[model samples]
Target: MFSATILSVLGSVALVAGHFTITYPEMRGDSFATGASQYIYPCANVNQTAETNRTEWPLTGGSIALDLGHAWTYAFINVGLGTDYPVTNYSLTNDRPLNITGKGDLCMEKLDLPAGLTVTDGQNATIQVVTVGETGTALYNCADIIFKTSATVLSSDDCPSNSNITTATVEEVSTNETSSTNSTADATTTTTTSGAVGTTSSLATAGFVGVAAVVIGWLL
Candidate 1:
C-alpha cells in the first residue's frame, strides 16, 4: 500500500509538470494540442475555427492569466501591436517569476499600454509568453487581442519599432536543485523553470523541450 501511494504521488507530480497554457483573454482554439503546441501567431492555429476568435477588449488595461502544468523559475511576457499576420513587431513589457513550486492552477497578471501611446479602437494586438530554463529550452504561448479604439487603422510601416518601448528584465534566481518560477505582469505573464541540480533535471530530461519548440514553430 505504501509503495502504491508513492507511485501515485510521483505520477501526479509528473503530470502536473508537463504543460502550460494561456487561460485569459481566451487563447486561440487548439484542443488537440497542449503545452507549446497550441499557438501560431495570435489567432492562427491548426484547430482554429471562427469561434476561436477572441473577444475584443479595451486596449488600455486588462489582466492575463496562465495555466501552469509544471513549475518554472522565470517567465517573460511581451505585448505587440500590429496589422500583420505573425505580429513579430512587438515590445517586451513584463519579466517575472512563474510557478516556483511546480503545482498551481492559474497565475494572473495585469497589463497596460505605455503612456503617450495610442491604439485605434479596432486595432489588433497580441500577447506572448516565453518561459525559459537554464537547460536552454523554452515554452511559448500567444493570444490575439482587438483593442477598443476609434483611431484609424495603421499599416505595418506606420507601426514603430519595439526600441521605443521601455523593457524590464528580472534577474534569475540562484539555486542548485532544479526548480521553476511563475510571474504575472501588466496584461502579460511568463513562467520559467530553473534550479540547482535535483528537480530541474527531470524537466530537462523529459525530452519535451525541443519537441515543444518545434511544435510551436510548426504551428506557425
Candidate 2:
C-alpha cells in the first residue's frame, strides 16, 4: 500500500514539474535609429522630359558628407519629384549605393543616375539622405540637367565619406540551452513514470482479483 501511494504521488509531481518547466527559452527583437532626416527635392528626371529639370545648390564646402554609423534600417531619398526611396532598393538596382550627402565634387550621390542627366558648372543638388543598418544601401537622384543647366560630375578618389557597418543582434540567456535540455528530459521522465504507474496499478488490481478467486475455491 505504501509503495503504491508513493508511486502515485511521484507520478503526479513529475507531471506538474514537466508542465511548468517547458516554457524556458525565448527570443526578443528590437530596432532603433541614431539619427535621421527628411528632405524633399522637386528635381524631375532630365531624361524623362525635355522640360526644365529641377536643380539644387552644392554644399558650401563642395561635398556632402555623412556618418554611415548613424543609421540601422532604412534611408530615404526623395527626388522632390517622387516619394521617398529606400537606399537598398536603389543600390541593388545599380552598381553602388547612392550618396545623398554629396561627398564628391560634382559627385552625384546617386551613382546610377540616367546617362542623359549631367551636372554642369558644378551646381550643387540637395539630397534627402536615409540610412538603414550598418550594411544597408542608398539611392541618390542624379539628374544631368537641373533647371535647364547641365550638371557635371567631379571625380574624386575619397570623396563621399564611409563609416563602419551597423549591426543588430539577438541574444538569449546563457543558461537557456541548459534549461531547454532539462525541460525535455523532465518531460520524457514524466511520461515514463506515468506509464509505469499505470502498468503497476493494472497489475495490482489483477492480483487482487486472482487471490480472491483462489480463496473462494478453498472455502468451497
Candidate 3:
C-alpha cells in the first residue's frame, strides 16, 4: 500500500515537472527538447560554445520573465557575468529569495542586477533561472544578454504577471544524516492561492534541498 501511494503521488508530479523556459530575455537554447535535462548544472543542455541570441538588457536593470512548467516553484535568480569559462560564477540577484506562484508567464518588470555588481556598455552576461519543485532537482535555464546604456525592457502580451499569486521567501531546511530537520533563512514562510474558484491544495517536498512547499491545506 505504501509503495502504491508513492507511485500515485509521483504519477501526478510527472505532469508538473516539465521544467521552464526564459521568455523575456531569450533562452540560451531549447532545454525542454526531447532527451534534454535542465538539471545539468549552469545552463542546462544549451550549447554554451555557440553564441546565443543576446538580448539588450539595461545597464541598471531590466525585465525578466519565465514560462514556468510547475504549478508553483521556489525560484532563484542568479547572474553570470562574462564568457570567461563555460561555467561562470553566478551571483544571486536578490537578497530576499523569490517564490513564484502559478505556472505560466510570470514577469518582473524591473529586476535589477546584483547590488554593487558593476557593468559597462556592451558587456556580456547571462541570466540564470533555477526552479525547484517536488522532484528535488534544481532545474536551470539561462538567457544570454549584452548590457547597454540605453536599453529598455518593453512589456509584451506574453509577459503578463499572475494575479492572486505568492511571491516571497519559502524557507529551505537542510537535513543531515544525524538530524532530519533543520530550518534556514529566518523561518520566513509564503502562502500561495492558485487554481480555479474552489481550489485544491498540494504539498510539494523538494527532498534534495529539504524544502516543502505549503500551498495551504496541502495533501501529503
Candidate 4:
C-alpha cells in the first residue's frame, strides 16, 4: 500500500515534468507538451512533414548532440531507415543502464552504425533518442537524417556497455559509470548511452522495470 502511494506520487511528478532536446541534428518538432501525449512512441507523435528539418549523416554513421534535462536518466539511441518509420523498424544503436544524473550538453562526435542496419547514399533515416529518468518514465525525441557517403565520420568506437559503437562522450561526468547532469569542462565521461525517458513499452525493455521493482522492494 505504501509502495503504491509512493508510485502514484512519482508518476504524477514525472507526467508533469521531464524532457530533453536534440541539439546537433535537431528534433523533428517540439512535442514537449505538459501531458502524456507529448511522451508518445516513435517520435512522440511529432509527425514528419515537408517542413521538418533534415540533416545529412554519413553512411558510416555520424555525430549527435543533445541537451538532457534529468538528474538520473537511462539513455538509448536508435535508428530507423526510410520514411514513416514504425516502432519495429527501429533498431537499438546504443543502450546504457544505471542511475546517473543527465543534464547539459552531450555530444557523440562519431558513431558506428549497428550491423544489418545499413543505408545507401541519400537514403532518408531517423535517429531516435530515448531517455528514462529516475521517475521510470521514457522520454522520446527524434532527428531526421539523410545518409551521405560524404558526411564526415569522427569516431566509430564501440560503446562501453554494448556492442553499439561510438567515438567518445563528453560534457558529462560521474564518479562511476553514471554521469552527472550539471557537467564541467574538464570532467571526463564514458560513452553515455542514449535513452527515451517516457513510454510504457520502452520502459519495459529499457530496464526501467528493474527500477520499479527496486522501489517496490524497498517500500514493502
Give the whole-model CA lDDT for all candidates, comma-separated: 0.48, 0.26, 0.65, 0.60
What does candidate 1's lDDT look like per residue over 1-220, in tens digits? 9999999999866644664566666676543355324323333243334554654656674555555554432445566776444453444342233324443433333456656657777777777665554443455666767777432222334322222112222233323444475543222222322211112222332334343453364346
Best by lDDT: 3
| Per-model TM values vs. the true structure | 0.50, 0.24, 0.67, 0.60
Q: Tell me the lDDT of candidate 3.
A: 0.65
lDDT of 3 at 45: 66
lDDT of 4 by residue, 1-220 (tens): 9999999999867654567787868788877644424467757778888888889888877887766667555556778787666353444444333344445555666657876676799988888877766666677788898888888744434211122222222222333343666543323334334421221211222243464454353225
Give the lDDT ranking, best first.
3, 4, 1, 2
lDDT of candidate 2 over 60-158, digit per residue (tens): 212232333232222233222231221222221122122222111121232333334444444423333333222222222233222213333333453
- Quickly count the clashes in candidate 2: 27
Better of 1 and 2 by TM-score: 1
**Candidate 1 lDDT (Cα, whole model)?**
0.48
Runs of candidate 1 exceeding 4 Å displacement:
1-16, 31-51, 92-102, 149-220
Answer with 1 or 4, whichever has the higher TM-score: 4
lDDT of 4 at 139: 70
